[model samples]
Target: MSTKRKHEVPDQQEPKRKHVEEPDQQGFTRKNAEVPDLQELKKKQTEVPGQQEPVREKVLDHIYGNKFWGPYLSERQWCTVREETLGNCWDSTSYEKITHDSYRWGEDGIFGLSDEQQKLCMGLTLWNGKDSVVKERFFGLTGPQGNLGEDVKELYFYLDNDPDHRYMKALYLYPQTEFPYTDLIEQNKEGFCHSAGKGVFDDGHWQIIVEYTKPESDTILCRYTVTNISTGVQTLNLSPKFWFRHDHDAKHMTDVSCFQVKGDESVVSVSYQLEPDCCYATYKLEVKPGGEDIIEWELLPVGKPSYIDNSSDVIQEWKIKAETFYNSLYDCQWSDQEKAVAKGAWAGLLWNKQFYYYDVDELYHRGQAVENKVKTVKPGNWDVMERNIKWRKHFKAKDILSVPDKWEFPWFAAWDTCFQMIPFCRLDPDFAKHQLLLLLSERYMSPEGQLPGCEFNFDDNNPPIHAWTSLKVFQMTGETDLNFLFNSYCKLQKNYNWWMTNLQCSDKYIFYGGFLGLDNISVVDRGCPPEGYSIKQADATAWMALFALSMVQIGIELTRHNFPSPGDIQKDLIKYLKDFLCISHQLNKDIDNGGMWNLEMTFYNDVLVDQLTEQYIPIQVRSLVGLLPLVACGIVNFSGIRCTEELKQALQTDSIHVCDITCGTVNFSGIGCTEELKQAFQTDSIHVCGVIKVRSLVGLLPLVACGTVNFSGIGCTEELKQAFQTDSIHVCGVIKVRLLVALLPLVACSTVNFSGIGGTE
Candidate 1:
């Protein structure tokens, strides 16, 4: 036998495999025997053509490839994905359509749906039968054409009758080609279904999940088996009665989310809340008892995807022909591997957020999870929990599966997917790779080369870190497909260009700043900039530098293939960087080239709007901005005498540089063991006010001092790293300071000179 395992795929065949957690990767069950004559007892292997050797998905496990608590919905876990809501709150006239562009929560209230679009926004009603079984139904697609490429696995069951029973329904509908759990479902109804006239939780009776994909399919496809507790055997005797598709069509508004039951026992009667938008749905299930020859059918939702805009025949016109089906999703099939790859063509959506949310706030302020599973119902019901009540969403065990797919459900972002990719890799590398491919697809990447931001809009520029993340992924697994990744690198450059040109405000560099990306929004506007900061913002400036660095690094990788130059696209990057450092004196250095360096402050306090409005603003030199010079790594092209020896000297221990801004006092960042920048950070006399006294500014000094733009080098000093890694840093300035801190080491500790940090030759 060859030294390599006989089963081990050849090098020309595949890359080194890392066993991930996707059951589908290694799980060729007995169902396979039923589907085909193939059988293997002593470890037989069947190969799916395009499927990569069964490497366990490492990164996907955390986000998209999530492991549910109980009986997980399916083998294909909920990996972190990106999407946007199809439309504004469905109550609006255009409920069927998705929001044409992307969006962010709270940025613009999703209150577009008015009282008019009643059909799209009608309240849900649980029509309780004489058996006390309340039922509602939703048909995802009308037929094979209607399936919408859904690789169904688990159910997201939630209770919508009360505030506690939340609504959080969104689906990514992954492709079966990459990773599929088709065998996850029970073949037959098995034993018995729950009896009617019963209720669950607080005196309710209902259940869902029907054993059917289509009606005419030879697979005995749609079987609904239910057995009433009181009439167990008798109920099992009943045949399934699923209504025909041509009969009545309906699409259920998302209502509830359920993973699995403790024992699949019958103590729970499903109920419904009558609120205008209370989520509501009906389903079927399987239960095998002591003596049942074959599986049977039970009760299901009243309707399937039965309703369409009879008012307009637009949807009817949408047809599926092999020749005609390219862009639209109407004809896509889950099983067709080729179509799966193509239809998943999203533009690079959630790139900037890949590394984020590793430890962001997954918990709500109310000591509950910030996430909540949703079931769709009427429109008004959603506003119910829109209050300050934060809930832990069901992204698998409330343990955050990857990063969220922000901007509703239709369009998710790029970077967020990367963060998601980390954990998802553990469950199914195939799925994890697909998620990456999904982001790289044409839809998610914009015409301008920008990938989708964290929000729904593909146009908006969020953070610029896609290419770097792609490399990180490549490093973890040498599955380098330069062709595809280079395209992502190109798109990332566009985003970088947009970040610099569009968001930049000052003649000097600083990105957008505000609560929701609005300019002038102070850092203290929400403790962290909330949306993001102004380009001219001190922190924003540093971020711009860091983003530019990522672009250069990734751009170099793509450059090898002679990828087209992004033009003078990012040519002006260094101009403002050098200008800002010299004029702003972020490090408090003065002299030469008409520089205007500002001093550091001693504390952390909001720059009162009234002070600026009244022309009485305190122009204190602070460490926050002083350390900004540390942000100019690999972006700014230095020219002339802009960078004086005086400026360079200030970075050392010989002189004391100031950089604070609390109570009108200046403070500093980027302190070395004995560097001049160290004095201001260590000085204890710096009076700081606030309920939490350990001034965050003092702790974040290392970030600026050890200036290196690499994500690993962020907060290079032990103390700064401790604060970021140790968590629980609840200071208002912490996020911004951390962001700046994260950027500085890239510049401060960089091999390049400060003036040329942003690529100034």
Candidate 2:
């Protein structure tokens, strides 16, 4: 008798010579059967794909990978179409059209967008797996929207053959997981997000580790590690899927083709060409358990590639690159968490910056519209339109360094770039130096020697701080490379001439609008001039004086190098130093003359005038405006050269001339003059007045200027020494807070001894 029942899987062939009697469902019968040993079954399991072998202890010297906090999605959602696409709907009264039209776009909207939206809006370039030709294409998730989508789906891993067919989904691992929790998302110094995830298989309780790495090549490597945790023998045929949407219209589809290429039994390669952009995706499978697999994707232009033979080697190279970066930071004294944060921040900055040519058409149209508006307002200035057209024509965009914070302010501000160089120099000196030169490059700087204030309004002016920053870089690196210095000196000289010729409000004073990078701080609006009055700003005068002093120092450094002929450099240095002294003296005389200073109040203020009356009054505000003059105080070591009576008088008198300034309304009472300062003021010698207030870069400017103080002849006072100590501590405390402030002490103080510090040489 025999009984039949549904088996899990149909047996293909029965074993030979195996005969037995079988009973109905209620009865049992004996039969010859073969049962494998438990140890043998385990051994067989080790041979299966996507399994981990038992671990053997070894010394761990280098750590190449890091984990990060994973993102969590409360519920699966779809991305909405952009607003410009609303006209594409065929039926106006249809439900989909109504929903699309009513949907608000932004963070607070019903369908909130992620940072990915901003990042992916720009198209990406891919290299063709077949050849060297690279192509540019926009990619997104499939959605109802015409071309782009709002959300992307999370990738999944599953077994190829399973009865229930369970799939393991990616998620953010928490403290409850057995694996160590680390918030390290592998990225280059510039914050680009690679792939990072940790999860487990539902059936076998196997752990899955996934990471994405991009090496020097055009390929992106998606690596996976699957390890079995359950004691029972487990088997899995793993399949990983990558689903993405590309901008392929009917024309594009006709022009391009995609196909799969067979490699060894364990490898699968897919290649596609979309005109200018070609992409290849290669999937590698590991045959033995406890091994890892990789999916490599490359995008390039469709052409003969320069090099593309060693795909596997490229993947390994990426791993080594990551390990090298990790090791570089590992030697630092910073904690692991701090290093991770620093790496993330640096990578973010690098990734966020965009390198591209400027949009000529958009700028041309905008300039014309502005010219028309200006002509209507000032009919007498008929040539405004011509000038506007000329400027528009001159505006050519090239590859340039972008500001790190692109989301809020996309344009590069000259002064901001100067400060950004400080940290960038630490991370990559070459890049930082390149950025400094970029501002003065012909494509950006106007032929008239005007450094652009920001990207949008090229004609606007920013503070002339480029020379100051350049000097700083030279000093920080202790680099004697006069090439950068010589080039920068030439550009800075032109800029100085421009400021003196065009921006001068009077013979001594420089006039500037609010575009001086200090918005809302000025009494009069910086962008607009007061009716009928030409205003002279104290900060502008101070900045020019500082600029002149910077030039003098650069010339001095050049003289030391003996490249530009010591005679010529010295002559230029003396001229600039005199100009700086003259400016300083004139400012002091103005304060004494009660032009912008309140004698009774003892504070400096901005002056507004009635243009017709030729009379000016002070816009009384004690802010950075009053404190700026201290920035102009560059100490001179007048050991060899003869000092003119006028120069000596200017230096001595200017030192005591105080623009009664307070941090704000809270007065530090009288100027905190050390006995030395008081004596110098009484005797008319160079010295600094001090005050107690909230510490700031501006407040500390005087100390920087005091670097050149001739303390040997004019004895240093206890009060002066105390003030220096207090200010030094305060400046040190805030060094990490602002990049500009941090670099100020190092660059301004000539006495700093960097003998033992590495890299000084």
Local distance difference test, per candidate?
0.29, 0.41
Candidate 1 Cα RMSD after full superposition onto the native fold (Å): 22.4
RMSD of each: 22.4, 20.8
Model 1 TM-score?
0.35
Model 1, span 491-518: residue lDDT tens: 5656566565666543334344322222
Model 1 weakest 10-residue run by lDDT = 110-119
How would you encode candidate 2's per-residue C-alpha lDDT over 1-761 as one tens digit per residue?
A: 11111111123221121112112110112111111113343456566655523210010001111111011000111121111122221211222223222211111111111111111111112222321222221111222321222212222221111001011112111111221112211221223222222342222333444333333222223334444444443333222221121212221122222223333545644433221111223222222333322222222212214223444465455555644554564547888788766655554344333332343322223211113111111112222223223345455543434464432243467898888777556555666778788878776677888877764455667778898889888777676768888889988888888898888775355455455876445656766767787776777877887898788777767765666666656666656766765566555544436244445445555676667876767767767776665676443333223333443343334432333321111121232323543453342222323322223345556545432233444555677656656533332222212223223211111111111112110
Best by TM-score: 2
Candidate 1: which stretches are off by over 4 Å? 1-90, 93-411, 425-446, 454-461, 513-539, 556-761
Candidate 2 to truth, TM: 0.49
